[model samples]
Target: MGLKYIEPIKSIVLLLLVLLSITFTLSIWTYTPRLDPIEQSPTVDISIGQRKNVKEIIKPYKFMIKNDEFMRGTTEQLDIDQIVNEMATWKITQLLRNPVEMNKKQMNEFFRQQNQFTLYFQGDVPLSVYDEILEIEEVNIPQFSFDRLVVKWNPKDISFEVHFLNRASGIHYYGRVTPIDTMKSYRSLVVGSEAYKNYAEVLQPDGTYLAVSNESLTIQKLTYFQEELSPTRFRDALFNDPNAVRRSQVDATHEEFGDDHASMIVDTDLKMLNFVHPAAETSESIKPSELLIDVIDSINEHGGWTNTYRFSHINPSYRYVKFQLFTEGYPVHSNAKETTEIAQFYGDDRVFRYIRPYYMLDDPLSEEVELPSGVSVANALMNSDQLDFGTVEEISVGYMMRHDPEQRVYVMEPSWFYLVKGNKNWKQYTPEQDGGEQYGLE
Candidate 1:
């Protein structure tokens, strides 16, 4: 009985040891492959919400003088004392460094360019004298007419006035001179020697004088002109109208498809569509009749081009069909020729009106897509059933579908295509490298 029990115990121990070994191997195999730390780490996710605050990082708005009022206000508000100090400092510095000299011509040219001079005359100076005065080396007469001269001068940094008047004694006399400084504070005054001497005094009837001096002048405070926004008459008209029709008309004027009858035709095929009748007047507003004619012309031109050297056949399986058209003239290459391809048309009768032949390949022997007279490519596509071509696909305008590597269907107005056939031999049809001759055989 003891031997039997010992044998059973030994077998049990062996079974336990086997199970333990298998468990250890399985645990090691399960965790043997380790992941790369960089690959396994979560990446930083940048969201659109985080970009909202980024706009605020743009530079601050800078203000500058943009109109006469702002300019006048800025000049009036300038600090006279500071300007005077700066002028004095500049003069002193220049004198210390061996005074720079300018010739009479140079001085005159500078004064004329700077617009810094005043004319002074006693009464009615002769035209000869006036001309002579203008001939003075540093004098420039006013471009506009004036009885009196009050000019801002550069060298002396002052405003001076010269008045010419007829005396009570029935004789002409000239002698009214006033310094701008006496009437107003000049932040800075610039005057040339000729201008300083010309308007230095004013003669009075009572033998008295009104002298302009530094004591009468004070620094003028600078002020900013605020810009006021006001509505124009046109804007008022729009706002006042209860119907709002005027506003719509104004808005329509700025649209590409606005009522403007003047259309820009960029057909490479030179298919002049009757967008505008010969007698129709092109104006700010485009008439619906003109647009209709244009659409028709576009379709006819495209059909004629595609049929010139190609023939397309209808596939029996595809019943209702649609045609997507593209035109040439992109990149404005003069030598480029127009080409079109049927990107996609459905065989299902549910979406199309009639099954028409859409050229899958550009073969010289293939039948061309037939088009009705005066029907635009857009209208033809939209009213496919009306044209008796096929059922129309209800795709929205501007929609596009890429069917193959070389074919794409675009949902646009039917008249948009001026040519409708893919040039499979586009490379051969491309203009010569020398740019001397056109690619296609005329």
Candidate 2:
């Protein structure tokens, strides 16, 4: 009986040892320790400049007020802002394409009518985009744009009428101003036109109008302290995957950065940057309104408005847009071609090409120089042999940006510019270029 019991106990103990060994082996293969969380690459938002609103970036640079007696125009910032603010309060309705066919003569007559205020923009601003600042009634708004807005007070109807005019394409839109009270503000501006300087509305040979001061006008020449921005900030802000970008020194004054899909070249001498994203290229044409809005949003997303820039030009056919730096209510043009403006070409709903100065204006120098009058400017333009008077579209005052390397500043010399048809380029007029009388005050 003792020998039988011993054999059974030994077999049971052996089976238990085999099961424990198998369990330990499985644990070695499948066990996981309590490890720490894996670290990730930190995402930091980089902003090299300030963001701006549509109203701030897209403002009227010039305006004209016409009454029964005479017409007055000004490029003063305050005056333009006042009118813009006043117009923003009113409700606009009944916007439609003007059905009446009018030739240049009839159009000029309508524009010169009494109790009229016209706001002129540098570029063809989309009516829908401007509706952000303007109070437009919700309706089937036409897809059109305007370079000027003509607001007229109808004393008979006791209301106001707004006309949107695209000087380039002759597309006209008319809207009725509402609340009935907005006319008072419009009237006040028109009635007070006498206090403002007188402007002579000269009809261009091309059937457009150019407003010039009757007498010699004076403007200020400004100087600004400029600061170069860091390339790393732009690389981080503009690139979708900044960490993957590789930087290489192209030369002493040029640096290039790129990844798999995009490239950016920094010209240290010019303090300008040109970025291209080939993947975003699209052959399809984008609507002017959408293109303009997208350009603003893209810059705002990265806070890329480095200086006081205003909407200067846009060619929808090529999906190209430009924002030029402005100072003291006047546009600024650089001696360096395409350097003083933030230019963009859109594709595939993304930024295809971006070229802009990587420098910001720090402060204005105390010294102020007086500029030549609009009268003299107009005279010079008309008398210039280099200019085709018939092809001349418009003339305006602007500043020529001359960079000073040693002092590290920009001297903004006030000058006159004449826009020509066909190419639509604003050519600068100087005593040397135009072979005209000296424009600067002695």
Candidate 3:
């Protein structure tokens, strides 16, 4: 009886061990290792999609809006905050992952909407110098229209800006495009004719190119300036110490403006010329804006002031303010920043000196010269030893003086300058290019 009972308990214990072994084996075989979250790069969706039909209702809308006649525009942009807020309230999103129904957990603010991005993709159709924008093929995007596309090419920096809009959907898409060299634009746009270049090579008395005739002859129906850039009157007005020399003079030489006055004198002497006073500060400091305001005040006396005339540089001593001049509404190029036009000088919280354009063409001439395009000039400069640019600050066409070796008469030729931002790496081609050196010299 003892043996029988012992055998039965052994069998039962053995069976339990086998079952436990199987259970443990199964657990090991069926187990899986957790994987890391799938990684993906951040991307922005820039699709211009149409709203889904309202309960499948059909409503016809214009497929295209026409504004192709306008070449450039300054379209007022909708505030970014306002656009975002509107998108949020409408539960509208432009993300590609958007599904008919999404788990609430997927709604993360970190995700970007599927709306158009500031930068277009590489494969997108790009604007060309010769592109007849009106004829360009339209894209098949929802709620998107080719209408109201604003293309701006700035030859100064060789920069392009494109703004694509959908007025109906209120989508604003824009970006600064990388400029490309177009052969037609390059070949056809040179400012200097072959004759002009050849003439420029002729030696002048001052060792400069004889680009224009020194005789001061007819130019584009306008007469070249015969008189020099000189101050109109000289007067003494001393303060703080009578022993200190103080003198003021006015120049009204701008050939174009006829009798509009320009002045040159010490900063304090600005008062003598009836110029607006510089603001007083407790610490004897004058802000650039203050000087700028003083310049604006002179518009009545110096009539050529325009929105294009910008404050370019201020002297290290905080004494002088240089205002850049513009030609045909475009900024004159810098080549190297210098006094293309001297605006004002500051000393002891007063405008001590002033110089402005008192001489220019009397009026626009009908003779159209095929002036070199900004892009063409920039390209030539890039290849030439003259200027290795960082970014061209501005470009303008103006007369650069040439004189006869014998008569010493002044001649003017329309020249172009590319005002490049200054840096140590830049090679100085001429002394006139140095705006910094000008502070001490001019």
Candidate 4:
């Protein structure tokens, strides 16, 4: 309470303030905040099966060459691959749509030129996506889709020109091959393909020409053993959270898997799966190039390339796509059920629906049955009372899948397949059923 005590009191107060300041500074330097952890998407990384490259799924099923000397073609995988590999080496540029009107007659003339060859794919392949398969130089590739790539050149011409044709939409794209020397190699490959069969250029109602065999030839019928695949693999791969999913057996033949957002149905008897994801559905239209790429990636994510399935069809308007089962270089169609196709319907950027078979074809039986030639088959189809020739878009040799209940095996009988315009169904044409005579070119 005196002057002597005042100095000591002030000193004590200053020391306490300094200690408080030091405490505040230390607390500010090492402060730890309490915040919630970041959440991750459940389906970010899902793998239930083997993945596949884009080239494996998107490949040509037929290759045809027409020149002044011969008209021949082949469905052999090896032959097709050889030509595709050669084309892949060439740099293609100036991919633009040919605005010139080309009718069926003009197109046929183009095909029957001095030297030309065509590679036919099963679906409308966007040129941008096909950049993965072909060596394309143009970075600003336009939005164009093609089912056929026709390479044509004349003996006098220095360069070979490529035409991408969409048979369904009647759209044609033109591109050029650089370094004219590529033509010599391409021509040689075409010349050396002796196994290619003789074909007749038959014009169809759709302004497309089907190269049917002109002579009588035989095709072997294949019978394969059957193996069923597990549906659980798809469930685990598709569902956002497999652990939170519920399974329900509708009957002996039908089973279902679902969560709060999506559901998948399994047709056990038919060995098919149908997956639907409503939450991923969107009404916005997606580019064909983007759609095709996304669907392939989605299937590859779950190793969905179970069998030798090739891209068969695509409808960008409906956002529907299909991959058909192929055997011995021929597409296989099921008469009993839609068991030979892997189909997808897109909703926005995601898959809205996926329908595919769950069976894998084993090795074929040794005994082979013979099939009539494409000419005879075409004749039979032309004479069929049930089928109108006008509706026939194209004709080819394909295997008709028939299941033998007693033996528990599936038989792939090589037969003539005719594509209908309205439905695009590849109906199996039997000679006896059609009441048409088999007559090859004399």
In terms of lDDT, the best-performing candidate is 2
For candidate 2, the per-residue lDDT at 34 reads 95
> Which runs in model 1 stand beyond 4 Å of their true positions?
1-159, 162-234, 237-442
Choose 2 or 3, whichever is better by TM-score: 2
TM-score winner: 4
Clashes of 4: 0
Q: Tens digit of lDDT per residue, candidate 1, span 1-442?
A: 8887998899999999999999999998897677666657684331211111111111101101111111110111123223322222221010011133434343323323333322222112222223322221223322111222223333343433222221211222122223334323233333112112111112223322111111111221111121111112112211123233222222321211112222211121222111111223222332222222232233232232221111111222322111222211010011122223221122111111211112222211212222222123323333333222222211111111112212222111111112112221111111122233323311
What is the alpha-carbon RMSD of candidate 4 to the true structure?
4.9
The stretch of ten residues in a row with the least summed lDDT in candidate 4 is 433-442
**Candidate 2 local Cα displacement, residue 404, angstroms:** 1.5
Q: How close is candidate 1 to the true structure, as a TM-score?
A: 0.15
lDDT of 4 by residue, 314-430 (tens): 788888888888887788887645478889998866789999888877778745667667777777676677666767767777777887756877887777777766565667776
For candidate 3, the per-residue lDDT at 127 reads 26
Query: Candidate 4 clashing pairs?
Result: none
* Each prediction's RMSD to truth: 33.9, 5.3, 29.1, 4.9
TM-score of 3: 0.32
Per-residue accuracy of model 2 over 277-339 as CA lDDT, tens digit each: 998887787788889999999999899988889997888888898997888888887653437
Error of 3 at 97 (Å): 32
Q: Candidate 2: TM-score?
A: 0.86
Task: Give the distance in Å from residue 42's predicted Cα in candidate 4 to where it truly belongs.
Answer: 15
Q: For candidate 4, what is the lDDT?
A: 0.77
